[model samples]
Target chain A: MSRHATAEQLSSYVDGELVGPRLRLVETHLVECQDCRRRLDGLQRVVAGLHRLEPLAPPPVLGQDLARRVRLEPKPRDLLERLEEHLRSTPLQSTVGFTFALVFALAVILYLFSGWVERQVLLHQPVLVAPSEVGAGAAVRRVGPRSFHAEDGRWLEVGVDPRGAAVVAVDDGVVRQLLVFEPELEPLLDEGVPVVLAMEDPAGGPGRVLEILPTPPEP
Target chain B: MEAAESTAAALAQSDLDLVERHRYGDPAAFEEVYRRYGEMVYSLCHRLSGDPDLAADLTQEAFLRIFRHVGKFRGGSSLKTWVYRVALNHCRSRLARRRLFWRSLAEPDEPGPEAVDPGRSPEDRAIAHDEGRRLTRALAAVPVAYREAVVLFDLQGLSYEEIARVLGVRLGTVRSRLARGRERLRQILEEGEPLAPESSP
Candidate 1:
């Protein structure tokens, strides 16, 4: 009240927005303050001028034009058109567009990431071949008279020439290669038994099996 | 107050019924809406845009919009407020695009032609014409935000609450804008020039 009523207070007072004590304070100030009273009068005059400006009637042809336009205009599908209009007019459109873009970007990123992971797996991947098949089949190529390498980097190191061939098993980065001559040892391999090979004598002879170890349980 | 509320509610219900009828292919329903709101729409658009020709075009556009989307009106707000919102939004967008809406009419390149009012005597008509022209120039000089509140409240005779609903602002904002708008308008009328725009607090 001592500040001659801030503009907000004066404005609110003019609009009857102030109530109770705020109203009373402005009323008291208005009665005693000539400057504030004059300012209030100016505001009142402007409001009066505004009210006096008569509302202009629409051009005589407005209704006719509107009717013609409406006739020409396509009728909107109720809920869908409403929603579309709302989205078009409001900030909601940008938000929806942004959300769609975000989803698309995320999907593309996930697809690319999955493809990259698959390629990496293919690059380092090693195929497991049964030793019985590799040692006796065309899949094994002779690197030397006694050594052969499987197409997938599994080495079949044959110490001596046996009636049967060598087979290898690799799992969890552990490699097990066996040179099997007897068909009975094939069951041991199938049963997940581990074996070591004994070297042949200096002269040509068949390699003898030294010890068979139990295969560890899979983790 | 309760009677007024009931009347408003009844009007809203009638508006909804009108929309439903229009959707159901009642030819007269839209015409009825236009008849009810045509002058109000035209007046609002004219006052805000300060051009009768533009107001006419905007009025047609607004009603066409209403005609097409009438089915979407659910009567959440009064039919009048919804119409005002749509009309005002269209004016805002179109005018902003042209960058011509906020130009001041304080200094006219040519004197506006006299407005013919058969209701008044010659002297009264001349005085009203001059006054109306001056008032229009002054109002146009006001900033758009304040101009909107003043036009809707004073020129259009909407209640403070209705203005808030139409402009989608708080009631307090409506009051503040009205006060500041009137103040700025008074300054322009007194000084006969466009005042520097004030940032709204």
Candidate 2:
């Protein structure tokens, strides 16, 4: 108000944002001030010219065209790409992308680790073997009634019926082997003979008798 | 008769209601919005870009964006303002890239002549042809930020608050930009040539 209304003040006044005593004071100064009034007039003329410029009517096809294009816009499919787009448009773009990248990377790493975990379990755990399948040279220890612990750390449970045939159970499956246990061996099996059986296939197959060992006393 | 009136009233829906209906999978609601805002958005793009073809492209781009992001629109601003903001942002990014491309080629950023419409009467064309050209040149001369504020305020008739919301700037910043923009436009009109490009404060 002192050195003449600045261009900003005059513009604000034209916009009708200036109010109260400030508006009145500017009005009083404008009445007495020719230079400020001229500035105001110039600004008004520029604004008026802008307003007078004809509004361009879009082409007749514009609506349909835009609608068609909008309909055609491809939706995001990849979750990461969709998230990237969402983050890029938001204020938190920078941090969100990095966080999502880390989470995604961690998920991949955990998925890979799960496969390794299965292999590691297989490597460290004991392999089961049937007492009948064990060969004569194999090391065997009788640990229970009709059960033997082999040197390879496998636990095998062997059962023999009165007909001189034997069955072996290992890892939740039964391996039926026609056993020609000698007539003497059949009674020993009925009395709980501990024998190491080695199978060609551990999952389920016919196994050979390797050795019959004395049953260890139960502790 | 009463049922017909009610149906007609329902058809005459507000922008927000139409957007809501579109969100719920109403294709007609989306088409209605497209019809309502298409011309205004295209015109805004045309004036801001000073290129009809580019304006059409930007117009399509804006609507595509709106269609995709409609669900994300929280009702903080009026639907009109939101649409305008989307269209203007598209224009701003494109013009910026065009400016960079032109600058790389050492070309001045003056807009080309307005596209002539054969449908217009000779008299109307004769009256408005020069005035429209001069206004376009003056507008092109103003820097992008200031030009945007001046266009939205004077040409499009958005209030300062709406301009602020659209531009994501403070109220004071809007006033400053508008004032400086008007001054620059006046100087360009008086000089009959665009001012050299300068950074806006």
Q: Tell me the lDDT of model 1 at B135.
A: 75
At residue A210, give the lDDT of candidate 2: 47
Candidate 1: the clashing residue pairs are A131-A167
Q: Which run of 10 residues does model 1 chain A get worst, by summed lDDT?
A: A199-208
Report lDDT per candidate: 0.70, 0.67
What does candidate 1 score on TM?
0.61
lDDT tens per residue, model 1, A20-80: 9889999999999998887777676666666656667776777887777777776645566
lDDT of 2 by residue, A1-219 (tens): 678887788888877889999899899999999988877776776776676556777777877776666666664234576578786787654587888997899999999999898666433222344544454345544432133434432343334232333333343344433334435555676677765544334434453444556545589
- What 10-residue stretch in candidate 1 chain B is worst by lDDT? B192-201
Tell me the spans in candidate 1 whose CA falls farther than 4 Å from its real position: A76-219, B102-120, B193-201
* Position A65, candidate 1: lDDT: 76
Q: What is the TM-score of chain B alone in each candidate?
A: 0.86, 0.76
* Candidate 2 stretches greater than 4 Å from native: A74-219, B1-13, B100-125, B193-201
* Best model number under TM-score: 1
Q: Using lDDT as the measure, which candidate wins? A: 1
For every candidate structure, what is the RMSD over all alpha carbons to the true structure, in angstroms?
21.7, 16.8
Q: Can you give the TM-score per candidate against the true fold?
A: 0.61, 0.56
Task: Residues B1-201, candidate 2: write the lDDT tens digits.
Answer: 999988645543465687677666677876777777887788788778777777778888888888877756666777778989999888778778877311321232333334466667777566455556676767777887898898888888888889999999999999999999998877767676432122210
